[model samples]
Target: MVDASQFEKLTTVAKADGVQQLVVGAVVQHEGKVLLLQRPDDDFMGGIFELPSGKVDPGESLDDALRREVKEESFLDISAIREYIGSFDYESGSGKKSRQFNFSVDVRAAEPIELTEHDAYLWAPLHDDLPVTDAVKDVLQKYRELRAVRRD
Candidate 1:
Protein backbone atom coordinates (compact mmCIF):
# COMPACT_ATOMS: atom_id res chain seq x y z
CA MET A 1 0.00 0.00 0.00
CA VAL A 2 1.33 3.42 -0.90
CA ASP A 3 1.54 5.81 2.02
CA ALA A 4 -0.39 8.89 0.96
CA SER A 5 1.74 11.22 3.02
CA GLN A 6 4.94 9.77 1.58
CA PHE A 7 3.62 10.18 -1.95
CA GLU A 8 2.77 13.82 -1.27
CA LYS A 9 6.23 14.38 0.17
CA LEU A 10 7.87 12.90 -2.91
CA THR A 11 5.75 15.08 -5.18
CA THR A 12 6.78 18.15 -3.21
CA VAL A 13 10.45 17.23 -3.53
CA ALA A 14 10.08 16.53 -7.23
CA LYS A 15 8.61 19.99 -7.79
CA ALA A 16 11.07 21.75 -5.48
CA ASP A 17 13.34 22.52 -8.42
CA GLY A 18 10.45 24.36 -10.11
CA VAL A 19 8.86 22.68 -13.09
CA GLN A 20 8.61 24.46 -16.39
CA GLN A 21 5.29 22.74 -17.00
CA LEU A 22 3.08 20.64 -14.80
CA VAL A 23 1.09 18.18 -16.87
CA VAL A 24 -1.61 15.72 -15.85
CA GLY A 25 -2.41 12.41 -17.51
CA ALA A 26 -5.62 10.53 -16.93
CA VAL A 27 -5.63 6.74 -17.18
CA VAL A 28 -9.32 6.14 -17.71
CA GLN A 29 -10.11 2.49 -17.23
CA HIS A 30 -13.42 0.85 -17.98
CA GLU A 31 -14.12 -2.88 -18.21
CA GLY A 32 -10.42 -3.66 -17.85
CA LYS A 33 -9.23 -1.61 -20.83
CA VAL A 34 -7.25 1.62 -20.71
CA LEU A 35 -7.94 4.60 -22.96
CA LEU A 36 -5.30 5.97 -25.36
CA LEU A 37 -5.44 8.93 -27.69
CA GLN A 38 -3.57 9.33 -30.95
CA ARG A 39 -1.99 12.60 -31.94
CA PRO A 40 -2.83 14.12 -35.30
CA ASP A 41 -0.33 13.61 -38.08
CA ASP A 42 0.40 17.33 -38.29
CA ASP A 43 0.96 17.96 -34.60
CA PHE A 44 4.02 17.53 -32.46
CA MET A 45 4.71 13.86 -31.69
CA GLY A 46 2.47 13.17 -34.58
CA GLY A 47 1.12 9.65 -35.08
CA ILE A 48 2.00 8.78 -31.50
CA PHE A 49 -0.41 7.44 -28.89
CA GLU A 50 -0.78 9.04 -25.47
CA LEU A 51 -3.07 9.29 -22.48
CA PRO A 52 -5.64 12.08 -22.11
CA SER A 53 -3.32 14.81 -20.87
CA GLY A 54 -2.52 18.50 -20.87
CA LYS A 55 -0.58 21.13 -18.98
CA VAL A 56 -2.24 22.57 -15.86
CA ASP A 57 -3.29 26.12 -16.47
CA PRO A 58 -2.40 28.79 -13.94
CA GLY A 59 -4.69 28.97 -10.86
CA GLU A 60 -6.22 25.56 -11.61
CA SER A 61 -5.94 22.80 -9.05
CA LEU A 62 -4.40 19.49 -10.13
CA ASP A 63 -7.71 17.67 -9.73
CA ASP A 64 -9.49 20.36 -11.68
CA ALA A 65 -6.86 20.21 -14.40
CA LEU A 66 -7.27 16.47 -14.72
CA ARG A 67 -11.01 16.85 -15.03
CA ARG A 68 -10.71 19.61 -17.59
CA GLU A 69 -8.06 17.91 -19.68
CA VAL A 70 -10.02 14.69 -19.87
CA LYS A 71 -13.16 16.53 -20.87
CA GLU A 72 -11.35 18.63 -23.45
CA GLU A 73 -9.41 15.77 -24.96
CA SER A 74 -11.94 12.95 -24.68
CA PHE A 75 -15.20 14.63 -23.70
CA LEU A 76 -15.53 12.32 -20.76
CA ASP A 77 -16.26 13.47 -17.21
CA ILE A 78 -14.10 11.93 -14.52
CA SER A 79 -16.37 10.50 -11.83
CA ALA A 80 -13.66 9.42 -9.45
CA ILE A 81 -9.92 9.33 -9.21
CA ARG A 82 -8.87 5.80 -8.23
CA GLU A 83 -5.23 6.38 -7.46
CA TYR A 84 -2.20 8.56 -7.99
CA ILE A 85 -0.13 6.53 -10.45
CA GLY A 86 2.90 8.81 -9.91
CA SER A 87 4.99 11.35 -11.77
CA PHE A 88 7.60 11.38 -14.54
CA ASP A 89 9.73 14.03 -16.25
CA TYR A 90 10.56 14.56 -19.90
CA GLU A 91 11.56 17.35 -22.24
CA SER A 92 8.89 18.71 -24.57
CA GLY A 93 9.44 19.40 -28.26
CA SER A 94 10.37 22.99 -27.37
CA GLY A 95 13.15 21.68 -25.08
CA LYS A 96 11.33 22.66 -21.91
CA LYS A 97 11.48 20.22 -19.02
CA SER A 98 8.02 19.11 -17.87
CA ARG A 99 6.70 16.77 -15.21
CA GLN A 100 3.51 14.83 -15.73
CA PHE A 101 1.48 13.66 -12.78
CA ASN A 102 -0.56 10.59 -13.68
CA PHE A 103 -3.72 9.26 -12.05
CA SER A 104 -6.05 6.31 -12.57
CA VAL A 105 -9.57 7.63 -13.02
CA ASP A 106 -13.14 6.46 -13.62
CA VAL A 107 -15.46 8.30 -15.91
CA ARG A 108 -18.98 9.30 -15.00
CA ALA A 109 -20.35 7.35 -17.93
CA ALA A 110 -19.22 5.05 -20.73
CA GLU A 111 -19.69 7.77 -23.30
CA PRO A 112 -18.02 7.74 -26.69
CA ILE A 113 -14.90 9.87 -26.67
CA GLU A 114 -15.08 12.95 -28.87
CA LEU A 115 -11.55 13.95 -29.74
CA THR A 116 -10.53 17.46 -30.61
CA GLU A 117 -6.77 17.56 -30.10
CA HIS A 118 -6.22 13.94 -31.05
CA ASP A 119 -7.17 12.16 -34.23
CA ALA A 120 -8.07 8.75 -32.83
CA TYR A 121 -8.73 6.84 -29.64
CA LEU A 122 -8.26 3.29 -28.39
CA TRP A 123 -9.36 1.27 -25.39
CA ALA A 124 -6.97 -1.62 -24.89
CA PRO A 125 -5.50 -3.65 -22.10
CA LEU A 126 -2.24 -2.37 -20.70
CA HIS A 127 -0.24 -5.36 -21.99
CA ASP A 128 -1.51 -4.96 -25.53
CA ASP A 129 0.76 -3.69 -28.26
CA LEU A 130 0.56 0.10 -28.70
CA PRO A 131 2.78 2.99 -29.70
CA VAL A 132 3.26 5.17 -26.64
CA THR A 133 6.00 7.09 -24.88
CA ASP A 134 8.30 5.58 -22.26
CA ALA A 135 6.80 7.85 -19.64
CA VAL A 136 3.33 6.57 -20.48
CA LYS A 137 4.52 2.99 -20.28
CA ASP A 138 5.92 3.73 -16.85
CA VAL A 139 2.60 5.21 -15.73
CA LEU A 140 0.73 2.15 -16.95
CA GLN A 141 3.10 -0.12 -15.09
CA LYS A 142 2.57 1.81 -11.89
CA TYR A 143 -1.18 1.67 -12.37
CA ARG A 144 -1.05 -2.08 -12.86
CA GLU A 145 0.97 -2.50 -9.71
CA LEU A 146 -1.46 -0.40 -7.73
CA ARG A 147 -4.41 -2.31 -9.11
CA ALA A 148 -2.88 -5.64 -8.21
CA VAL A 149 -2.31 -4.47 -4.66
CA ARG A 150 -5.88 -3.27 -4.38
CA ARG A 151 -7.16 -6.64 -5.56
CA ASP A 152 -5.13 -8.34 -2.85
Candidate 2:
Protein backbone atom coordinates (compact mmCIF):
# COMPACT_ATOMS: atom_id res chain seq x y z
CA MET A 1 0.00 0.00 0.00
CA VAL A 2 1.07 3.57 -0.68
CA ASP A 3 1.87 5.74 2.28
CA ALA A 4 -0.36 8.73 1.64
CA SER A 5 1.71 11.22 3.62
CA GLN A 6 4.95 10.15 2.01
CA PHE A 7 3.41 10.29 -1.43
CA GLU A 8 2.19 13.82 -0.79
CA LYS A 9 5.61 14.86 0.42
CA LEU A 10 7.28 13.35 -2.60
CA THR A 11 4.82 15.10 -4.91
CA THR A 12 5.52 18.38 -3.20
CA VAL A 13 9.24 17.89 -3.56
CA ALA A 14 8.94 16.99 -7.20
CA LYS A 15 6.89 20.11 -7.80
CA ALA A 16 9.38 22.23 -5.91
CA ASP A 17 12.19 20.91 -8.08
CA GLY A 18 10.24 21.66 -11.27
CA VAL A 19 11.18 18.26 -12.63
CA GLN A 20 7.74 16.74 -12.88
CA GLN A 21 4.94 17.33 -15.37
CA LEU A 22 1.39 16.88 -14.17
CA VAL A 23 -0.66 15.00 -16.75
CA VAL A 24 -4.20 13.83 -16.28
CA GLY A 25 -5.84 10.80 -17.85
CA ALA A 26 -9.41 9.55 -17.91
CA VAL A 27 -10.82 6.04 -17.87
CA VAL A 28 -14.24 6.36 -19.45
CA GLN A 29 -16.41 3.30 -19.15
CA HIS A 30 -19.62 2.32 -20.88
CA GLU A 31 -21.44 -1.01 -20.84
CA GLY A 32 -18.59 -2.50 -18.78
CA LYS A 33 -15.90 -1.63 -21.30
CA VAL A 34 -13.22 1.02 -20.91
CA LEU A 35 -12.48 3.49 -23.69
CA LEU A 36 -9.03 3.49 -25.25
CA LEU A 37 -7.66 5.63 -28.05
CA GLN A 38 -5.13 4.68 -30.70
CA ARG A 39 -2.51 7.30 -31.37
CA PRO A 40 -1.87 8.42 -34.92
CA ASP A 41 1.17 6.85 -36.55
CA ASP A 42 3.18 10.06 -36.60
CA ASP A 43 2.82 11.10 -32.96
CA PHE A 44 4.98 10.12 -30.04
CA MET A 45 4.15 6.63 -28.83
CA GLY A 46 2.31 6.42 -32.08
CA GLY A 47 0.24 3.38 -32.96
CA ILE A 48 -0.11 2.56 -29.28
CA PHE A 49 -3.36 2.66 -27.32
CA GLU A 50 -3.92 5.00 -24.40
CA LEU A 51 -6.56 6.76 -22.37
CA PRO A 52 -7.76 10.31 -23.11
CA SER A 53 -5.05 12.41 -21.51
CA GLY A 54 -3.01 15.61 -21.61
CA LYS A 55 -0.87 17.92 -19.53
CA VAL A 56 -2.48 20.34 -17.13
CA ASP A 57 -2.18 23.95 -18.21
CA PRO A 58 -0.41 26.43 -15.97
CA GLY A 59 -3.54 28.04 -14.56
CA GLU A 60 -6.02 25.20 -14.84
CA SER A 61 -7.21 22.76 -12.23
CA LEU A 62 -6.73 19.02 -12.81
CA ASP A 63 -10.46 18.45 -13.37
CA ASP A 64 -10.69 21.34 -15.82
CA ALA A 65 -7.66 20.13 -17.71
CA LEU A 66 -9.04 16.61 -17.83
CA ARG A 67 -12.39 17.82 -19.18
CA ARG A 68 -10.73 20.02 -21.76
CA GLU A 69 -8.38 17.26 -22.89
CA VAL A 70 -11.19 14.73 -23.23
CA LYS A 71 -13.22 17.16 -25.33
CA GLU A 72 -10.26 18.22 -27.42
CA GLU A 73 -9.10 14.73 -28.21
CA SER A 74 -12.39 12.81 -28.41
CA PHE A 75 -15.16 15.45 -28.52
CA LEU A 76 -16.71 13.84 -25.48
CA ASP A 77 -17.73 15.63 -22.34
CA ILE A 78 -17.14 14.20 -18.90
CA SER A 79 -20.39 14.35 -16.98
CA ALA A 80 -18.97 13.27 -13.69
CA ILE A 81 -15.58 12.34 -12.29
CA ARG A 82 -16.41 9.21 -10.37
CA GLU A 83 -13.08 8.39 -8.72
CA TYR A 84 -9.38 9.20 -8.54
CA ILE A 85 -7.60 6.04 -9.53
CA GLY A 86 -4.01 6.93 -8.58
CA SER A 87 -0.80 8.21 -10.19
CA PHE A 88 2.32 6.85 -11.82
CA ASP A 89 5.50 8.42 -13.16
CA TYR A 90 7.31 7.67 -16.37
CA GLU A 91 9.74 9.35 -18.68
CA SER A 92 7.99 10.70 -21.74
CA GLY A 93 9.34 10.25 -25.24
CA SER A 94 11.07 13.61 -25.03
CA GLY A 95 12.92 12.50 -21.89
CA LYS A 96 10.79 14.59 -19.60
CA LYS A 97 9.88 13.18 -16.20
CA SER A 98 6.11 13.02 -16.27
CA ARG A 99 3.49 11.97 -13.77
CA GLN A 100 -0.01 10.97 -14.80
CA PHE A 101 -2.97 11.40 -12.49
CA ASN A 102 -5.75 9.10 -13.58
CA PHE A 103 -9.45 9.14 -12.81
CA SER A 104 -12.61 7.26 -13.72
CA VAL A 105 -15.04 9.55 -15.50
CA ASP A 106 -18.56 9.26 -16.90
CA VAL A 107 -19.37 10.66 -20.31
CA ARG A 108 -21.89 13.45 -20.39
CA ALA A 109 -23.65 12.17 -23.51
CA ALA A 110 -23.96 8.88 -25.30
CA GLU A 111 -22.62 10.32 -28.52
CA PRO A 112 -20.08 9.00 -30.94
CA ILE A 113 -16.41 9.67 -30.17
CA GLU A 114 -15.25 12.10 -32.82
CA LEU A 115 -11.54 11.51 -32.74
CA THR A 116 -9.26 14.37 -33.68
CA GLU A 117 -5.90 13.20 -32.40
CA HIS A 118 -6.12 9.43 -32.58
CA ASP A 119 -6.54 7.20 -35.60
CA ALA A 120 -8.79 4.62 -33.91
CA TYR A 121 -10.44 3.70 -30.62
CA LEU A 122 -11.44 0.67 -28.63
CA TRP A 123 -13.64 -0.24 -25.70
CA ALA A 124 -12.15 -3.10 -23.75
CA PRO A 125 -11.62 -4.29 -20.23
CA LEU A 126 -8.13 -4.52 -18.73
CA HIS A 127 -5.84 -6.95 -20.49
CA ASP A 128 -2.15 -7.68 -20.96
CA ASP A 129 -1.89 -6.96 -24.67
CA LEU A 130 -3.51 -3.52 -24.92
CA PRO A 131 -0.37 -1.92 -26.45
CA VAL A 132 -0.03 0.75 -23.80
CA THR A 133 2.88 1.61 -21.53
CA ASP A 134 3.39 -0.31 -18.31
CA ALA A 135 2.52 2.81 -16.37
CA VAL A 136 -0.79 3.09 -18.17
CA LYS A 137 -1.50 -0.57 -17.54
CA ASP A 138 -0.87 0.01 -13.85
CA VAL A 139 -3.34 2.88 -13.85
CA LEU A 140 -5.98 0.75 -15.51
CA GLN A 141 -5.47 -2.01 -12.98
CA LYS A 142 -5.80 0.50 -10.16
CA TYR A 143 -9.11 1.67 -11.57
CA ARG A 144 -10.33 -1.87 -11.95
CA GLU A 145 -9.45 -2.65 -8.36
CA LEU A 146 -11.11 0.52 -7.10
CA ARG A 147 -14.35 -0.31 -8.92
CA ALA A 148 -14.34 -3.82 -7.53
CA VAL A 149 -13.95 -2.48 -4.00
CA ARG A 150 -16.83 -0.05 -4.49
CA ARG A 151 -19.06 -2.81 -5.82
CA ASP A 152 -18.40 -5.00 -2.78
* TM-score, predicted candidate 2 vs. hidden true structure: 0.85
lDDT (Cα, tens digit) per residue for candidate 2, span 80-124: 877778777777888888888788899987468899889998888
Model 1 residue runs over 4 Å out of place are 1-14
* Candidate 1 lDDT by residue in tens digits, 1-152: 23457445644765696767778899998888899999999888899999999988876667788889999999999988777888898888788788888888889986777998998999988777657988898888888888899889
Number of clashes found in candidate 2: 0
lDDT of 1 at 2: 32
- lDDT score of model 1? 0.84
Q: Which stretches of candidate 2 lie over 4 Å from their true place?
A: 1-14, 127-129
Q: Among these predicted structures, which one has the highest TM-score?
A: 1
Q: Supply candidate 2's per-residue lDDT for 115.
A: 91
Residue 87: error of model 1 in Å?
1.1
lDDT of 2 at 69: 97
